[model samples]
Every structure is written in C-alpha cells, then in structure tokens.
Target: MTKTFTENDVLKYFYNEVSKLEKEKIEDFLSCNNALTEFYCELLTTEELLEGKLEKPTEKTIQNILDYSNTLCLQN
Candidate 1:
C-alpha cells in the first residue's frame, strides 16, 4: 500500500527525526505534491528567518537568574 504524509510527517522530516526509508518516502511525496512542497519551502524560510532573529538573553536577565539561584541555595 502507498503511504500518505501529513504536515506532522513533513515536520518530522524537516527536523531529520524520520527514519531513512520514511525520509525517502516523504521526499517522493513532496516531489509529487506542489502544495506540500510549497509548505515545506515556507517552513524552511521561516526557520532561516527565526534563526537570524534569535538572540541570547541580556546580561541583566542572566544576573537575575544567578541571583535567584543563589537565594534558593541559601534557603536550602
């Protein structure tokens, strides 16, 4: 029987969480489906944009976390 893929399966493929055989199946599935391929492309673009926009927490936030941890340690 032929397999049908869902958006969830595509996400699994995107994250490389699928098995090798499943990855091949999804690649074939995407090749035949324009809409799904477009969706996957959009996901890729979004991931790129998100990666570019990602930032580390500010020093103040880091300090606050350290201070809180110190307080917790003192209480124990």
Candidate 2:
C-alpha cells in the first residue's frame, strides 16, 4: 500500500528540513505522484533562486549601470 504524505511533509521535503527517512518517503511520494513531483520541482526551483544560484541577471546589465554613473559625474 502507498503511504500518503501531508502538506507539512512536502514542505519539509522542499526545504531539506526533514530527516533522511522522511526524505526517502517524500522521494517515494514524488516518484509516484505527478502533482507532488511538479510541486517539488517548483519548490526546489524557488529554493535555488532564493539561494542566489538561479536566474542571475547578466553581467552586462550591471556594467551598464556603472557606465551610466560614470557619464553622470559632475564636471569640475
């Protein structure tokens, strides 16, 4: 029989906040449930993005702001 996980179980899984055994259970649920898999995937993506490891803006955009600042320097 398949074990059912609760929302808290899923949340803990997403945050890597659960014990190894619980994580294993979450993995089992994710493997068998499409909705859970998608939820897990989105949660992982959000966590990664929050960790500054995803969707970083381009370096050129940063450089452009610096360049614009240089153009605004006060004339002596």
Candidate 3:
C-alpha cells in the first residue's frame, strides 16, 4: 500500500488477471481511497460494457458458410 499502484494494475484486477499478491495490494489501497474506489467502479462498468459483444453475420454470410460446408461434405 505504501508503493504506488497504476491504473493498469486496476485494469488487471478488474479482469481477474492479477497475481494474488497484486490483487491484495490493489484491494487494500482501493479500500482507503473513495475516489480510487469510484474509479475502480468505473473500470468495472467499462469491463461490463465490453463483455458479451459478438458480431452478428448477415443472412447472406450465413448462407454462404452453410453452402461452403455442404460442398465440403459432398466432396468428402
């Protein structure tokens, strides 16, 4: 907690990719600082926003893939 932690460390913690030691240190630091806690919340919200975003293919694209697969199956 005495040493400085960066925003990148916070991002890493949000993604659960931090080491146990680093996560503990970040949590300890965040607990005492209201502003940092708020920022962490923002980071969590941002992460949430970035989740579950799969691109939808057009109908023609889907048809094309199916057609290609059918051809491959016929060849085999």
Candidate 4:
C-alpha cells in the first residue's frame, strides 16, 4: 500500500523521528512535490533560526523558580 505523507510527517522527517523507510519515502515525495518541498524548506529555516536564538533563563528567573520551590516545600 502507498502511504500519503502530511506536514506532520515532514516535520518528523526534519527531526529524524521517522523510520528509515518513512524517511526515504518522504524524501522521494518531497522531491516530486514543489509545495511540500517548500514547506519542508521553511521548516528547516525556522528550526535554524530558533536554534540560533536559544538563550538560557536569566539569573533572576532561576532564583524565582528556586524561591517558588522553597515556598512549596514549606507548605508541604
């Protein structure tokens, strides 16, 4: 049986979450379909941008989390 792929499947392909067979099928499908290929490209660009923009929480944010945990522990 032939399986049809969706955007979700393409995202799985992007993250290497799909099985080897599914990955091969998705790549073949993307090669044939311009629109789906474009969507996949967009996902790639968005992922790269997100990776580039990653940042750790501020010290204040970490302290706030610890303070909240302490309050919860006191209440317990």
TM-score of predicted structure 3: 0.60
How much lDDT does each candidate structure score?
0.95, 0.82, 0.86, 0.91
Cα lDDT of candidate 4 equals 0.91
TM-score of each: 0.70, 0.56, 0.60, 0.68
Q: What range of 10 consecutive residues in model 2 has the weakest lDDT sum?
A: 67-76
**lDDT per residue as tens, model 3, 1-40:** 2966777778788889999998998999998878778889
Candidate 2 ranges with C-alpha deviation above 4 Å: 53-76
Off by over 4 Å in 3: 57-76
- lDDT tens digits by residue: candidate 1, 1-76: 8898999999999999999999999999999998889989999999998988877899999999999999999999
Q: Model 2, range 1-76, lDDT digits (tens) per residue?
A: 7779876789887778999997887888888888877777888888787887557779999999988888887542
Which residue window of length 10 is worst by lDDT in model 3?
A: 1-10
In the order shown, the candidates' Cα RMSDs to the true structure are 3.1, 8.1, 3.2, 3.8
Q: What lDDT does candidate 2 reach at residue 54?
A: 56
- Per residue, candidate 4 scores C-alpha lDDT tens digits across 1-76 of 8677898999889999999988999999998988889999999889888998877889999999999999999999
Number of the top-ranking candidate, with TM-score as the measure: 1
Which candidate, 2 or 4, would have the higher lDDT against the true structure?
4
